[model samples]
Target chain A: MIISVASGKGGTGKTTVATNLAFSIGADVRIMDCDVEEPNAHLFLKPEIEEKSIVFTPVPEIDEEKCTFCKKCAEICRFRAIAVMDQIVLTFPELCHSCGGCVAVCPEDAISEIGRELGIMEKGRVNGIDFAHGKLRIGEAMSPPLIRKVRSSVESDKGQLGEKNVGKINIIDAPPGTSCPVIAAMKGTDFVLMVTEPTPFGLHDLKLAVEAVKLLGIPAGLVINRADIGDDTVKEYARKEKLPVLMEIPFDRKIAEVYSKGELIVEKMPEWKDKFRDLYRQINEIGSVKSASHKEK
Target chain B: MKIAVTSKGPDLESQLDPRFGRAAYIIIVDPETLEFEAIDNSENVNAFKGAGIQAATAVSDKGASVLLTGFCGPNAFKVLDAGKIKVVNDAKGTIKDAVRSFNDGKLSFSDGANVEGHWT
Candidate 1:
């Protein structure tokens, strides 16, 4: 089963839940950190990266010598990356989505795609879990492409590592927000475990996330971190929404200190390992029921 | 010469809009005859990205030789420059007043983009 851990707001313990859950689940599990912009799972997991590869996105390059300034390429580009004026045709590589629409629309065959480095993807193993993540280059606005690249590594690994050994449980640590990057990471997952705090801001963003997952037709459950510090607004919202509260980690000073020091809570407190395992079990139960109903539909 | 003035309304009497990309309307006026046409700019205002570039294209396609607006960004400036459209920055008052200022040489043309992209 493929499960994704996500949060709508930042610093809501997504990395904490994802890493601990991977450690608890043990054998035949893969963890992919799809938060390309700020992948923090590596800080806690500390997987010794065995392989690294650069990621690239194709951006348009104009062939000025063979061009007619027909303005067709400019008119067809939705991103406005290309502009044609009289004798000049300018292409802004930064604004290009690499959709290749301009190239296809160009009557003179003047546009060609050149690869631009967007980020890097690294693969490693931590404990027994196979790990992979993408790190987007600074100032890069597009991250969905990098996130997709990281997720695709899971498929490639399944083929190389043998289907039986790799497909048991794949957990994706998704980025914050309900935007393109988050959706890209959440796609094709059996379940989404949304990590959230108990405050009003947490509850507000949680609603937005829940809506996003619901739109994608994925089964999701909530994990409320620092559950005791804030009001019960999150729990109330979850109750009204009929969403299950899978686990609640009360605000503990020791846990906070350990987390601040880049240590996994599950490793420090072995008893919490059982709690994470139970969280996985609850997720499995929910997944089975949701899939069964989906099959019926 | 055809001049495009960013305006808050569809008429020449409307106040000049400070924003180039997110302006409500583009009033194209023939300065010599005072004849004009107003084009809605609502499309660029709601655009998620590349609004300035798209708005520049719109103004260029209207066959306007000059653009009068409060501010212009780098991307928009590049397109407008390539289109050979002179941009008069920090343009205030109504479309008619802006046109008068342009004719009287009271307004100065921008050397380049006056603001960063997404300045609102």
Candidate 2:
């Protein structure tokens, strides 16, 4: 079962929940840090780096020698990446979506694809849990490509990680937001574990995240971090939405100290390990039921 | 020579728009005859990205040799350069006055784009 921990607001503790969950689970669990823009799960997990590979996405490159300024390539480019005006065919490489529509539409066969470096995907292991993350190249505007690369790495390198078990859990620490990167991480996952605080800002963004998850038609639960500090609005919102409050982590200074020092909470406060383990148990129970019902459809 | 001026409205009396990519309208003017055709640029104004590239493509396709605008980004400026279209930046007058400045040689071709790409 794949469980993606996501939050609509930044600093709501997606990495905290995800890393802790992976550290506590005594099963075949692989945690992928899909927050390519700022992957902090590695900071907490501290997985030993075992392998590294560069990730790339294809972008169009026009072959000027093919010589037909037919404007077809430009017309088919939805991103406005290329433009053929008179004798000049201008290509904006950064704007290209790499859909290859321009290459496919070029009757003169003037377009070819070239790889643009998106980021680097690193694979590692902490205890028995396999860990992977993507570090995006600085100044790269888009991150969904790198997020996809991190998720795909798990599938590609599954054999080397461990023997594939039926109950293997892949925990995805999704980027904060309900945008493309978040969707890319949460989509196809068995369950979405939404981490949020109890404040107004948290409630507002949680509504947006829940709206996104509802559209995706996936079963999701909430893990309210700093649960004791904020208002009860998040709890009320969850009740109204019929979303289960799976776990709650109170505002504890010890947890904060461990997090600040780039250490896992399950390692320092051994009691919290059971809490995280229980969180996984709830997810496993809920995820399997959701999947079983999903299959009936 | 034909010049393209980014404008807030379709007519020559309209104010010159400072933005190049998200301009409301592009006025194609003939300085010798004072004849102009207003091209609505709403399509580019709502673009998520590459608005400058699309706007530059429109100007290049319109056969304009000069572009009078308040600001041109690097991407639009590059496209304009490849089309050999001279860009005059920091334009603040009405469309009609901008044409007069172009004619009187008061406005000079900018060395490069005044602003970075993706600027509002």
Candidate 3:
């Protein structure tokens, strides 16, 4: 089963929950960080790098030689990446969606595609738990493409069996916000583990996230971090929304220190490993129950 | 040569719109005859992105040799530069007055975009 950890607000404990769960799940799981813009799961997991690859996205490039300055290319470009003046045709690669519409519409065949640097994706292992993440290039405007790339990489690697890959549980550490990148990470996952706090801001953003998950038709639960820091509004909300509150981690100084030192809670406390395991069991139980009801319907 | 002025309304006496990309109207005029046509820019004003580029396309398609507006963005400036359409930034007052300044040779073409792109 694929579980994606997400939060609408930034600086929530998505990385913390995802890393701990992967560490506790231990052998039969692979953690993929789909937050291409600022992937922090690797910081705590400290996975040893084994393989790396550079990722790229297609953007339009124009050839002036064989080109008639027909305005057709410009007319067909939805992004306005291609503009044709009387004498010259200009192409703004950054604005291009690489839809190839301009190339398809060009009567003179002047437009062609070239690869633009998206970023780099690295795969590694931490204590037998597989890890992978993508780092978007600085100033890259779009991240959904890279996030999707990371998702596909993990699923594709899972297809090539026989390398002691006895795992089917894929944990996705999604990016913050309900935008394209977050949706890209959460799409196609079996369950969504939403990490949040107990504050009003958390409740507001969690509502937004739950709305998004509802639209995606995915079953999601809550893991309340810093549980005692704020009010009971979040819990009240979870209860009212019929969303299960699976786990709660109190605001503890030692937990913060361990996180700051880039250490895992399952490794440091050792007892919390069992707690994370319990959390997974609860999720599994809820997932099965929900699916059974769907089968009945 | 024709000059295009960004305006808040569809007339020569209309207030000059500061932003070229999201201007309400684009008045294409001939300085000699003072004859003009107001092109409604609602499509660009409502654009989610690339408004400047779309505006530039409209201005160039109108065969305007110069554009008069208070602020122009980089993307529009790129298309205008490619079209060899001179952009005079910081244009203010009524549309007619800005065109008069151009006719009197008092207005100069801007070097580049004056403001960063305003993303919605």
Candidate 4:
């Protein structure tokens, strides 16, 4: 089963929950860090990357020779990446979405796509768990494409990894926010585990995230970190929404200290390992029920 | 020369909008005749990204040789520069006043972008 750990707000313990869950689940489990902009799972997992591949997105390159300054490319480009002013045609590679609409609309066929390096995808192993992540290049605004690339790479490698006779569980550590990148990371997962703090900001962002997952028609549960520090509003909201509170990691100085030192909570606490395993079991139960209902339909 | 003045309304009597990308309207005028056409920029005002570039394209498409606004960001500046559209920023008052300042050479042309991208 593919499960994604996500949160709407940054620093809400998505990486913490994801890495812990990966370690608890043991072999035949793969963890993918889809937070391309600032992937932090590696800091805790410390996977020895065995393979690396550069990720590229197609950006338009205009040919001045075959180009009639017809302005067709500019008119059709929703991104405004291409501008045609009289005799001059300029293309901003950074702004291009590489939708190929400009090339299709170009009467003179003046536009062609050139690969622009956006990021890198790395695959490795850590404590018997297959690890993969996408690291976006600094200043690159587009991350969904790279996130999709990392996800596809994981999916393609699943068969090879499955030959070990161990049950497969794909854990995705998604990026923050309810934006396109977050949605891209969470897409295609069987279950979504939303991590949040108990604070008001956390609850507010969690609502947004819940809405996002609901819109995607994905089953999601909540994991409230630092559950004792803030008010019970998050729990109240979850109750009202009929969403299950899978686990609550109370606000503890030791957990904070361990996390600050780049150490996994499961390692230092040891007891939390079973708790993460329980969290996985709850997700599996929910996944089975959802699939059963889906089959009924 | 054709000049584009970012404005809050469609007429010359309207206030000159401070924002270039999210300006409500862009009034393209022929300086000699003072005849102008106001193009709505509402579509670009709420754009999630690339608003400046979209606004620059709109102004360039309107055949404006100059842009008069309060500020121009890097992305818009690049597109404007590529289109050879002279940008005169920090212009205030109504659209008519901005046009008068341009005609009188009171508004200086900007050498580069005055504000960072996504100032709002």
The whole-model lDDT of each prediction reads 0.90, 0.89, 0.88, 0.90
User: Candidate 3: which stretches are off by over 4 Å?
Assistant: A156-167, A292-297, B118-120
How does chain B score by TM in each prediction?
Answer: 0.95, 0.96, 0.96, 0.96
Model 3 per-residue lDDT tens digits across residues A1-297: 788999898888999999999999887789999888888999999999899998888877778898888789878777778777776778887777667788788888777788988899999998888899999998887788888888887674433544544446789999999987899899877789999999989888999999999999888999999999999999999999899999999999999999999999999999899999999998888877877887799
DockQ of each: 0.43, 0.62, 0.57, 0.49
Q: Please provide, for model 1 over A3-23, each residue's C-alpha lDDT reduced to its tens digit, 9 standing for 90 to 100.
A: 999999988999999999999
Q: Alpha carbon lDDT of residue A238, candidate 2?
A: 99
- Tens digit per residue, CA lDDT, model 3, B1-120: 898999999999999999898999999999999999999999888877788888887889899989999999898999998888999998889998998888889988898998886541
RMSD of 1: 2.5
Scored against the native two-chain complex, candidate 3 gets a DockQ of 0.57
Interface RMSD of each candidate, angstroms, one decimal: 3.2, 2.6, 2.4, 3.3
Chain A TM value for model 2: 0.95
Cα error, candidate 3, residue A204 (Å): 1.6
Pairs of residues at least 3 apart in sequence or in different chains that clash in candidate 2: none
Chain A TM-score for model 3, please?
0.92
